[model samples]
Target chain A: MSSSTTPALPMHEVRAEATWLQRNKMIVTPLLFLLPGMLFFAVYVIFPIFQSFGISLYRWDGLGEATYIGLANYEELLTDRNFEISLVNNLKWLVLYLLAIPLGLFIALFLNQTVMGIRLYKSLFFFPFVLSQVVVGLVFSWFYLPREGLLNTIITGLGFDSLNILGDPTLATYGIIAAGLWPQTAYCMILYLTGLNAVDPEQVEAGRLDGAKGWKMLWYVILPQLKPATFIAFVVTIIGALRSFDLISVMTNGGPFGSTRVLSFYMFERALSEFGFRMGYGSAIAVVLFLIMLVFIGYFLWQMWRDEREARRG
Target chain B: MFPTPIEKRSRAAQITYQSLLPLALILWLLPLIAVMVFSIRPFSDFTQGNYWGVPSSFELFTNYGMVFFESDMPRYLLNSVFITVPTVIGAVALSCMTGFALGIYRFRGNLLIFFMFIAGNFVPFQILMVPVRDLTVDMGLYDTKLGLILFHVAFQTGFCTLFMRNFIRALPYELIEAARVEGVAEWRIFWFVVLPLMRPAIAALSVLIFTFIWNDYFWAIVLTQGPDAQPVTAGITSFNSQFVAQYHLMSAGSIVAAIPPVAIFFLMQRHFIAGLTLGAVK
Candidate 1:
């Protein structure tokens, strides 16, 4: 109103004279825009995290809960053989899953060439990553079927005895990990392939001039430039390792007497599975997994924070 | 370029590289190829112990028809479509606003909020399982597609926000500034200026989220049940349980379930990879 009468009024004065909501548009607009997403996120993702933590302190079934068991769930974890096995298996997953990055890098290096049908090869190599993990798990399970399965068929053709990959307790976790790695390695390979495209050809040529060929050239010249890709690969690989559920869910269901159980699957089996709805025990297990993820999450955030600072400086 | 590019190598080396390429690809896709082969094989082949032999007769249509017409696969596929399309729209719509707010505005707690989305995304789903299910049940939405859709929309927002924020942040700030100087409304600045610039990001994210939500299995089992609400992944798993020995039919079902994502990936191959590796190269 004041701006209409006073035509010479500056923009700021007009903005100030506007409605209160208009005057505070910057703060109000962002909050207005953020409201719906934040509400849903808080309700579904954020709050449940704490809710799960609180439920961990008690021993309540999902329905009609009224029992405060005060750390009994966590205490039980210390002696729980199942939890112990799951943790060990998860550790194995984390360690073995790292192989994907290097394996992926190797394939990427092998295929990064100007050749016929290279693009087709790249897409085909990425085929596994596109399929549902359910399908991958099923396919691998079929592959590992005793005598009739493809893997065993090949093994028997070579005069080796058949192995029930998903049936053997000792080897079941490894089988599932191998299946998981198929798609994971494809994912990392794509990342590295994209990273390879961004590498400075000039630096690589200079390194070759300095007699850095073969692995030496890759290590000294190329690898440094691929740090971003390597970091992402590790992040994704590690996260995938911890969250190894679908394959286990589809292929084995933590079976052969739960030898292949990882924390994520174990959490589900305890809390939501047909056996029982031990919500508190499962939440406790989930809390443990959350803390484990927090270590990597911290490192990721710290690295990103440092990168942000550098970006700001530049 | 990092490798020796094979052309400069000796003839023997080049020949070996060329031959080995197909061999490696075949080995890598052996499982998928096996599944495809099984999909076309007649069930009589499996009954007669011809699992590894050549198909007695190609029954591609018969197998796929059974999966589509005889089984509950069609309903499950429809459930997936219903759940996924809405989720893609909801998550993308939510993130566009949140991404604009966080990406364009310099505000207190901006990093905190954005990182919350990132951290929430990385946290395992196990933590949210019990309560979210309970919450859905309490709301009388358990076993409903809407319940699953709502949960997915919320859960995926964590990821979609991180994606959109980075995308919108990379857009030229001058466009937004110029709009503001022209006295355009703030929402109009978003609707007309930044939103138009976000087309590629939207396409990429839509394809990515479509794949993610379509491929989801955990929450499908957690929140929904039966052919009424369960997606193809969970449904297919249940189907596997029912017909544990029917590899041919199972393979056909898997092929049916795999078509949408595989088609999307091939059609939008560039966008799919771009979305997957968005943060990696940078």
Candidate 2:
């Protein structure tokens, strides 16, 4: 009966001699194969998402008896100063983090040449992305150390007062973003490199013959062909920007004056930190963030669905 | 091809380009280079403010030795290995089966299920945090390596499934059709025909997942705590506080924590890149 749906398989002759399991293998097999993964994913990933939304409507310490306080957690978010700061910073992150795409393209273009040991150079440029964000955060924190850091060493040597980037509230977020871009740009560069590798040589030659050169060639001819790569680069960069938790956690811990608190770090601080166990409040923050991310996720899925449809047709 | 090859350029431009490449690389990696230098220096150099100068003495072994034996760094590292390895194995294993099921079957809700995995993979960790932590504690697995491992595996499966299913889809349909024509059992076909052909995807996903799980700081902290279960990413925080104001030790510890993924990446460079840029071409 299950084999009826599997158009790719023809089991008519074998069906008469087979057991129920073998006859229903197409459906049963996939269901059996999907069960463990789906169960685990549902238990760990899927259910928790809805549970978080449910939990957000109630005020409960994680361990204590819960009290339903419908929408209070979210109402508080409206007036919360830190929430405002975090929201603005998230916008800042969203906009600035995209710089990695063009920056990555620039680097990829720079190193796209076939020279001696260029492969090694490409790998070296991509080095920062391989390291954990914890490590990257640590390294950058040290790099921003006012007195002992390399940045200041160069600054002081150049007859200027050494600046404390991370300690300043206004500059701290940008400081972290710059550290983030180091790896993110590297990631984007690799994407573009791979994209550039697949670019049609004939079209490039045609454009060149028609008097396209330098930026004009890149903008008119190459960029259109690199659309898939740019799309991916856009998706990952957006995700990376929003998922900027580890670096902030390590660098400032929502520091100097609670200036660097994005929704992610702030949510953790409320829910789990020594300040208090405001699980409901944290969940509300997470929900807002989830909503923001949903926009991008929906866009990505629609694009993918379109591509999948195209692939099936073509 | 897009930029016109350097061989097509002038001689002076070529020499200048060659010189700029290394210089740009050095500048780009300067922060990491500084950390490497700091890891090799004695504490005296930092105290004396000799940061940019030549190290007064190289104490690489001593600092790293302290991190290994004197601190809980070794335990944290071992926990990271235990947590990461199992998660990699479990996630990859589950996804291979899931990927095969989703990729090959023409069932109702196939695209829906595939989209579920993809969308879940993109969700923020914070959304899953409060409940996942609660769930772990209720199961009496909190602050244990196994707790971290289970959560990592489940979370990572979303991604691994997306990767593996696409890889399986790209495999020749004729191969599976031919196997079906030979009257092979479905499971037998998966095991004998598809699984063997999936070796490259398996290898690529292994290294990719290893790097991701190893570098995962968010879940490590949320699901576990302390040296007993915390991976190196979290452990490095405690290690830093222990050696607070001890820049040399912190540098050595971070470098040690970062080495595994970096080594794996360098060794499996081709497979690593292949896994990363999977859909970029299309």
Candidate 3:
């Protein structure tokens, strides 16, 4: 019972031991664990942002010396017609891509029940999102092919003239957007399905007891709980819309008179592709795209921060 | 459950709903179904204008082999695996540490760093494209699989860190505190205690990152040019161009390019969906 009193160690020895532990563990341990990750992240991700910003003010073809030219590229962007087209197309993408959220919610609702062979149904529906965008683009391109394509065949079978979707500038952007929606809707559906799983059954039953059903029940009860899912859906859809390069690249190569060009594809064309290595102009385009994204980024961070604060409080 | 179940509906309504499901699915997936059919059909079917009929002959194996023998499809597949695997392991390993640091620790710049990751994760690839490419070239990694892996690992770390941090933060802090009070070293606590709990997160991220990197066409085109480093997504582009009129071969190649990720998804559908919808629901 009195073991503490039996052995009295020197206070200096105890202090020395505690200090050594602190030095070796608290300070050194975290450093060892953190250094490798932070270093690479800083070098490749964090450093590149500032470096790109710096290069945006210079005229350089990736290899040669970067000549200083402050704001000239940005100034040129103001009058560039293609930049204008890309910007407009980006706006169109942002608007049209939001459709996926509702479409996905509908699909999720349709498949939410426990039915026979439902697992197979869900997987089949989820199949599109699993495939690569390259495949999606190729498939859609074939679908939109002029004569023998699925779309034209369907149209011609109905005694209508074959509609040239990818060939027509006005319809080409919409055509690509539709193809993009195929997977995006699937992604949204998965999110909504997960959301639906966690929804309180009691609330639905209570709403039913109160004679609230269908859209009324959804708006009044279900949607409130689905806020988190909807917020994520919105954020991802927005990001997907802005970062739509692969589909545009594969399906049209920003072709049919550059009408379908978004900023990402346009930037790629300017900087990397065989079109021309106007690195400065490309960076300028990148800067604009970055600025556009910054708005949403700020909003997303604020929302996340607020949510974390609420989570902490709870 | 919010909407009325189809079973409870009138018989007419039930029949309409049940009958419409397959039709809707078919219409929704018409493009994909068309490609699937075309991938199996003989080349003569296209030339003969027998687009809607049964395939003249099933040529799936022949077409698939043609993609590999006639083109750089094998190299592309190898490049994809090379880039994707390393990037997944590297990003996940790094993020586990960073996430532990940010999530478990209460430091001055913790929130700042977390928000930085969140913001950085959302930035367009274009913003980083020029300098990233230049940096890769300067480091002598341009047009190499290593260059693609490096960028992907770095880029994906932003997202992975966010996910891992939130996941770790949700773990009971008392366990770490209890270990520390027992005089356990911080690194040991992380390795023995925290790392084990991260298996689910790691699995989810592995599948998700595998898909993202495998399907990445942009970086493949940007960082790597030739067959030596190009992944299947970009390689399929070249295949498409070479087989301009050969729809059967192109379709076959597209199917081949899609198989890996599709297999991963089907094998791990639950984890894949869970990973995708991680932040979507509370």
Candidate 4:
């Protein structure tokens, strides 16, 4: 009987061998699937960062021959008034942009109820975030457009003089920041809404039973649970503040004596725009921005690492 | 759940709250509403201080026509679509593979690579500006949609990869083990077994990317200059310059430029929120 089944045994062995190959195929297959993506990412994203760092060390117009400038651009940046102004404005933005978090929390708390047509109201509130910043800038510019603008029309209706929010050097930056806050606050509201959804109802009930009410309930029980949402809102708001170029460009073009020139927009004006294409100096400004962001990036990465490790351990 | 519900309050409080709701919303949206109203108002309304009043005449069509015919609005729209669509497709497709590899495979540098992506996603765009622009010019892709698309796809990969990897990681590991025991190839396991389950993630990512790339003004301005490659955001800047003081036309153009992403948000509001708040809840 064993000899009669020998041919069938060979066929069976061949099928088993094929099965073994298939089972172990992943050992070699993922590389094939990952190559194209990795290549594109390396070329377009990863490599360019290093390339930019290299370019920062040299002086070159985009078209002409390149010349190495070493720390000369950095030396100039140390004494550059415009760079200082831009840096100061960025600090202001960082400080003021944080207002979005509290404002967003207020709005989120206001709209958290299960009222009739609440969904439509929520969406309507979120409309600003959906639109482009350019549109937001335009809308705000019109609103801030002297006496005939919406803001002034309302101010005058109350018998106050029309305020030129964008024209005044002192107020221009704040005006632009206010426009930025509109969408950013909406963004934060959405995050808080999500966070509110996951709040421990039992904790809330217990707090209420303990005679906690109003601000006490919020301060003692609710706000602590919304830490994750607050953290993200703070992070994105800071980044948004630092990267605030569009509103500056659209609203006032960093006008009224360049009072609103954040580092990001200042870098763009120096490097690319018609501001003499000072590539090396522009790179220097970028390096400063990069250094500022590096601090936060490191913190965020550390936090994320800790979270992941804790998740895995649990 | 955090605050006392409006209904549980006294009658006067509820009435006051309801009244304040619309008022707060109106104040919050005053700028946007002003633009919407101005888009339809005649030029005289702006000139004659009738901004907040009813439009003197319905000039919506005429103003919208001016944006397209009098300016390079059509070209700008095309440029935006060209750059955004390709970037979304390329970034999503690449991340799907990268995500699968990093999520499932136990590798030495997996965490390191994932962290690289997360860090890269947060870095300031200005830091990458000089070298990226130079590279684009070197490759003769500057002032072209291709240049913009390549950069966007690359930059967006950091984000897309982070999202995709986290999404893929949350799936049950046993599915892959079972597929392996059944003698399925790894690539086949990814394509036939895991890929189908990524539909919700893909949908979420696609809409998010579409809105992000479509509304990107920074790269649009940095990479391209002329109408030939200028996206709507940058194009509007130029139009603002050309049509300075023509508030009616500018408002119309703003509305036109805003339509696409707003439409996307309404269509995929759930996915958009989910994608945005991926890490917020937990």
Q: Identify the candidate with maximal DockQ.
A: 2
State the DockQ of every prediction: 0.62, 0.74, 0.56, 0.52
True contacts kept of 3: 0.69
Best-to-worst ranking by DockQ = 2, 1, 3, 4
Q: List the residue pairs that clash in candidate 3.
A: none
The true-versus-predicted C-alpha distance at residue B252 of model 4, in Å, is: 0.8
Model 1, A1-314: lDDT tens per residue? 22322222136554436776666677778889999999999999999999999999988887785599898999999999999999999999999999999999999998899899999999999988888999899899988999668899899999989999899999999999999999999999999999999988899889888999998998988999999999999999999999999999888989999899999999999998787989999999999999999999999988988887787688
**Which portions of model 4 miss their true places by more than 4 Å?**
A1-31
TM-score of each: 0.97, 0.98, 0.95, 0.94
- TM-score of B-chain for each predicted structure, in order: 0.97, 0.98, 0.96, 0.96
Greater DockQ among 1 and 2 belongs to 2
With candidate 2 superimposed using the best TM-score fit, by how many Å does residue B84's alpha carbon deviate from the native?
0.7
Question: Model 4: DockQ against the native?
Answer: 0.52
Give DockQ: model 1.
Answer: 0.62
Question: Compared with the true structure, what per-residue lDDT tens digits does model 3 show for residues A128-215?
Answer: 9988888899899999999779889889889999989998999999999999999999999988988988999999999999999888
Expressed as tens digits, the lDDT of each residue in B1-282 for candidate 2 is 878899899999999999999999999999999999999999999888899898998898998898889999998889889988998899999999999999988777889999999999999999999999999999999999888888889988999999999999999989988988888878888899999999989999999999999999988888888878899999999999999989999999999999999999999999999999999997
DockQ of 3: 0.56
Q: Which residue window of length 10 is worst by lDDT in model 4 chain B?
A: B102-111
lDDT of 2 at B132: 95
TM match of model 3 to true structure: 0.95
The candidate maximizing lDDT is: 2
